[model samples]
Target: MRVGRGAREDRADARDIEWPPSARSPGPAGRAGAARALAAAGASRHRARDFAWPGAHGAEAGVSGCGRRNILLVIFDSLGEGALASMADALPVLSGLRREALRFAAAYAPSPEGGPARASLFTGLDIPVHGVWTDGVALPERETTVAQRLAACGWRTWLVGRRHLAGVSNWTTEHARPFEYAHLDWAHGPLHRSRQNAYLAWLQDRAPAAYAEIFPTQANADDTDCPDWQRAAMSALPDALSFNRWVGARSCELLASHGRDGPFFGIAGFVIGETMGAAPRQSSPCEALQERALRQADAALGDILRQLERSGLAETTALVVTAARGSVAEADTDAPMQESAIRVPLMIRSPGLAAGTVAQAVSTIDVAATLYALSRVPPPRRLQGAPLLATGPGSVGRGWALSRLRRDHGWKTALRHGRWKLVVSHGDPDAGVQPGFSLFDLREDPEESRDLAADQAHQGMLETMIDLMIDARVAMEDRTEPRIASF
Candidate 1:
């Protein structure tokens, strides 16, 4: 069936189109796996020695548990913490997954949107540390992404999604990145159908006739990957041919290819419920559409898990399912630095960790560090976030979770210290307190309607927040000596 009008465009120029529309390539080369090599030398057991969670300043969380397990990371664009709410009737499958997984109740994105947030995850460092304070700007090549580090450790790294990994700035590839996989030919970004063309092309070549007929419209289709060419959000697609379904299909392919013995790292990025939180206009009617996306994504997830089980790799793979933020969803604005966004969902289903909810406040930056530890690779000294699942009993979350947003050349940073959160934007560059700030008691007002910054009662907390932000920035910038990371 004809779903909607095909966006009018010249096919001749389609392949050349990049995300960010005009994004330029920067120096593109990962550091020579120095940190990972070091980690490999020193790392012994797959599990942690004790409960060594990182402190306010991204200290050593000791080392994570488990080793050489395949990594399966599924990032659902902007689906935030709101999915855990009772009103999230659309996320039945995800809710079920969370029930069985080791959950992080207060996970954060570290940035207001996908570009910077993902940069944080790939690098294991915050905005100030990585210098990827915003989208559109490519993370400098000098920084080693997690994928690079993992690949260096004999792990087959496969990136299966769209979004900036390298620096394509076309409308569709806004989150797209440079083709950085060590050994994959189809590892480039597509205009639609999202990132994983390598897998889709493999499917097409494996059974061209069947693929051509998977959807009814393909009978007369010209582009072959019609759903992809249409640029429709994954939420807007039919279940049989949805982007989420493709995620499952691609993940299954990757799992099948790797088998049970090999080590691998895979990232499946899908536009689903999460995008609604940070930028509603990127999606609309968040509840209904996100519900559908969640179902499709869950279906893909189920397909993946089944593949893992069949391959006997389920227990060997360390799976991470999280979104960029919890929910930037507000009535008026969609900003990820808000409490909901800063408190997105984080679940870890790994061989070393048991099922439980981590009440600690972790940020997206920690993912790379966790992955490195899980792979038994040495994380870079410059990495800021600490590993989670590795800690023993009685371990608390970091003293704070960090978030930042770039309004222009300058930026503002948010600090979430326990129940209180302070957002400080660019003040006088010298003073850095041009009065652009807000503070809230998240325990009481998770929605952040109440500003406790000016209150006498929270004055001490406010000072603590300010000190945390100031000290962290200074530390981050001062140590810009090329920390290794991935995006």
Candidate 2:
């Protein structure tokens, strides 16, 4: 493991890192320069106002063409598509939003783990390109996030709840990158005792009794031996004091307090279902815990949406709801390469866009591209994803998604193209284990019960999928700084 920097060294390193030109100057002059840069890229603010969906009506029709819209990206950790569908009736708010949102039927995370998956969502780059292949891996400072890009273009960026861009440990709070977020309310988890945890601080200030009962500050009162489920249950307080509710309340406050001066970008990261437990004694208890957490999270989602409507920002705000990775309940095995492990819920409710299901397969990395499209900011050349709103041929609704998992458990890669899904296990040669393959026709077996890799009849299909996977990996090779000259 790499040694973490001391507080003083961390501060110095943050100061030494070069910020973007717009970030260096915080007033109108910086904004104007960013505007000029947008103009040079043929995406001026004025042109952004005129932007409209193809075959869609103009300003009179209430399409999102008025100006740059505020963006609220809500990520529910471990909330998979299956879980959402199964709990739809219990989650009235999410169900209602789904009716009026553009839902992606086949959305996959870039990685089957939280850190790399979120890194891809933020940077629009694959896990390999970003090098955050597992949890605890720090995102390189050089990679620019969509939040930074929007902040550079004069948007007020805020982050509430968890942001696993850096490793979260019991010893220290995770550090934020410079100018990454203008305002931050960070809490790694509800039970975390990090002094920087905003949730616990809020509990202490608002509900001292509950805070004292739940979080005794004595170092000897260690509950490390207790199961995660029991700990989560103990920490799960009333609606007003719950971690998810706190995140929702803060996001609503941010939205309510904002003026009409400039567009804003906020990320509300909720961690309820994610902490149900690392391992459950029984599936029933785990399922029940997850269900309860989802219901709470649903209420939180409702709070944010109602605040948006009540504050009159609903019409001009683009709401994106997705997950970093799937839940343990959805996965059939402990392996991270399964479809259930990476397939997540993704939906976008933007101005002027019609609500419907998009059948094309897409990756969460596309969320970054979609944000840039909504804000009318020219996405950096390093972005590997295309705008989700782009229409006609060669659009982002490509019928394929890729997910990678490289961790202590194993190195696995999964590719979904058309109806076929292929998973390749690059076993450790040093361990004397040979590589393995698993193929499934999702249409025929959505549960992925039977693997067709050894079937004689499907040999041709397996070879074709192998070739497609190889081509995809080659295509996704880092082009952030493409070679201009052979010399």
Candidate 3:
């Protein structure tokens, strides 16, 4: 019963902490009715459509049958493509997956922040459309998620770790929309003080010694006062009790229990790489910390994949590995529109798809469309993303990848066209300044060192890119419920 040191003493203290049973059980279904009530309340204003049940669509081109396929989506927070490539040697499992899976070198997140980026990935909508433009904003309950869609289509959906679709200011519990996840191991971050955080609860039950060491005072103590990197370095928790490992174990448990029941859509989200936890060293450079977190994540991923194989669900499952945003280092930069801030590692290993690298630009939103395709469900009309599996290697993923940042000061948008990247910033309107722009030919300047916005010779290209940016924004306008017939 004693999983960690000082388990006996910690058990005495655990009695004083308030732990919710729902944290260790299946998610509540009561939200489904609440969702209907909210919809009815706003029916006159919004006119949301009813949920469309999925029918048997024809099989995808490369896939064998029309049966629904299992989906395993693993997301690492703030993991940049550059970081993954730089530390490939240290990540054996992930590197091996990269070689065996369909690697997308030019994949980009829809937003550079966790909330908006994850919203786009789940809803296949742009930041403006979904309305989760930044970290603190809540995803509107009316907006349907991929998990809800799949659940309606007879697929079991589960999520483990880091569902930041809504605000997490309250420490008692995290929020969940209608039927978003059948089972959830909710933890906004490793060090969050939520009593409903399943990761923390698991530590209390299974590894009380480690829990007592990490949180010496109260079970819900706010340990976030210390910087994440410093806390990670100073922590006494072992690799076995790390957050990512707990997420992986929960995912494997779900797989083993539900693999034979029906097709399932599961997400295992790892936050270590972003928060700089689970490192072996007490203190290290930023790069070393990130690399160590990645290695730990790799080990956890190996466990999940091996569990998939053991359950005989490997071939029937479409495995997706990606990041919610880009590198943590981007936080220190002036502008987050850089490639290192938005570009992320993306790979997919499906039953019939050939393993190869794709250089075509793709957005994280495409992952939602691809999941719908794999499940034999028609993508909703409002989805702005196209399935990547339908596109060839040379063909563009979504024609271009777009990233957006919205703050109190202004709005910053970046558009990546064939070889060019255009970044436009609209300053606060009251300041009375015109929008400024920057152009970079990624082929020539991959690091985006030189800005061509002021160059006279590249004026023509800049104008063209500006037009594309305008067109893209116009195209992304909300179309969730179009006026079928002007009444």
Better of 1 and 3 by lDDT: 3
Location of the lowest summed lDDT over 10 successive residues in candidate 1: 17-26
Q: Write the per-residue lDDT of candidate 2 for residues 1-487, one digit (tens) a residue.
A: 1112223322322221122343333234432243233223222221232233232232123223447789999997776787788788999988987788988878899876778899999998888888887777899987889888778767899999888787654334787777868899998767666778898788889988877776555422233233455466555677777888889999999999989988999999888654432222222211112666677778998999999999999999999999888765543355566766788898889889888887666789878878877876766666677566653223323446789877355678898865778888888888776688998878779889999787665654565556556656766767566457989
- What lDDT score goes with residue 430 in model 3? 75
Give, for candidate 2, the lowest lDDT window spanning 10 residues.
Answer: 280-289
Q: Record all residue pairs in model 3 with backbone atoms less than 3 Å apart, i.e. clashing.
A: none
Candidate 3 residue runs with Cα over 4 Å from true position = 1-65, 170-172, 219-224, 227-230, 233-236, 273-289, 328-330, 429-434
Model 3 lDDT per residue over 464-484, tens place:
566556656665667566456
Stretches of candidate 2 above 4 Å error?
1-66, 217-232, 274-289, 330-332, 391-396, 482-487
Candidate with better TM-score, 1 vs 2? 2
Task: Rate residue 289 of model 2 by lDDT.
Answer: 26
- Tens digit per residue, CA lDDT, model 1, 1-487: 0112122232212122111112112112111122122122212111121112233123223333435678888787666676555444656667777887888777777775566787888887777667776665688776778877666556677766554544433222333234446434332222222234553465466556544554334222123233433334423435765556766787788778775545888887765643322222332222122556667777788888889898888878888888765544452353335665556777888886778876656677778878876766666555666676654225643435677766542356777655667787565556453645687766668778988666555554454456555554543443434435873
lDDT of 1: 0.57
